[model samples]
Target: MNKNIILIGFMGTGKSSLGRRLARRLGYKFVDTDSAIEEITGKTVEQIFRKDGEIRFRSEEKLLVRKLSGQSGLVVATGGGMVLEQENVDLLKQNGVLICLRAEPEVILKRVKNKKRRPLLSRGDLLENIIKLTKERESAYEIADFSVDTSRLTFDEVLNQIRKFLQQEGYIK
Candidate 1:
C-alpha cells in the first residue's frame, strides 16, 4: 500500500471507521482529518462550528488535507463536506487514490440520527438536509477513483470491498 488512500463521503458513511480498519488491514497509518482538527484545535467539531464557524473549520480542514497529501502509506478519512472544495479534492487526488463511500440518504440519516457531534445535522429534518447535501455534493464525490456503497454493509464487509478494489487497481500487492 504505497499510495495514500483517501476516504470521502457524507457523514455516517463509515469513512472514519472503515478507513481505520482498511489501514490496519493494509499495514498503513490511519489519519482521520476530523480527529486531527479536533486534536489541533482542542475543540469538538460542533464546538468549532459554534464558535469559529464553518468557514474557519473548513480552512483548517483544507490545511490538514494538504499536509496529509505529502504522506505515503496512509489511509485518510475526510470529513463529510471536505470534498466540497475543489482544492482539497485536487490535493487528495494528487497524492493518492480517492475513494468515495456512498450511502443512501435514509441510511445516512438513520446512522447519524442521534449523533449530536455533527453540527449540520443538529436541526430538525435531518433526512431532508442529508438529501439536499447529497444532491449538491454528488458531482464532487463522483470525481473519486472509486465508489463504495455502504448502506447495507458491515464494517468488515466494507473493508473487504475496499481491499478488493485496491487489489484490482494494482495499488496493493
Candidate 2:
C-alpha cells in the first residue's frame, strides 16, 4: 500500500494546516510543495510568480513533482493548481493517496485574505477570482480518491474524515 498522502484542492482549503497535523498524527514528514519551491528558489511563491510568471512556476513545479512523487512516507500538501497538469496528477498517484480538500469560496477567501503570499488572490476582485478558479478546477479536484468539505469543519474534524477514508481504504488498520 502507498504510504504517502497527497492533499490537493483550491487555495485556502486548509491543506497546509491539515498536512502538518496529519503528518504529526501519522508519524510522516510533511512537505508543502509551495514551501519547497520557495526554499529552492530562495524566494516566496509571490516572488516566483512576479519574476517568472505562472508558466515558469508550473514548469518548475512539474520537475519538483516528478522528483517528490517518487519519495515515500510523506504527507504532501500540493498547490491549488497542481492538478491542472495531468503529468503532475499521474506522478502524485504513483505513490500517494490523493485527497481533495474542499470549502466554499467565501470561506476560502476569508481564510486567505490576510495572507500576503497568494499571488493569484492579490489581483482585483478576490471573491470573483475564488469562484472562477474553483469552478475551473472542480474537475481536477473531483478525481481525488476522496474529498472532504472543509467549509465548516475544524482541523480535527477534517482530520477525522481523512482518517476514516484511510481506514476504509485499508491504508490504515
lDDT per model vs. reference = 0.90, 0.92
Tens-digit lDDT string for candidate 2 (1-173): 45699999999999999999999998889999999988988988998899989998998799899989778889999999999999998999989899999999999999998988889889889999999999999998988999999999989999999999999998876
TM-score of every candidate: 0.96, 0.97
Query: How high is the lDDT of residue 156 in model 2?
Result: 96
Stretches of candidate 2 off by over 4 Å are none
For all candidates, what are the clash counts? 0, 0
Instruction: Please name the candidate that would achieve the greatest lDDT relative to the true structure.
Output: 2
Clashing pairs in 1: none
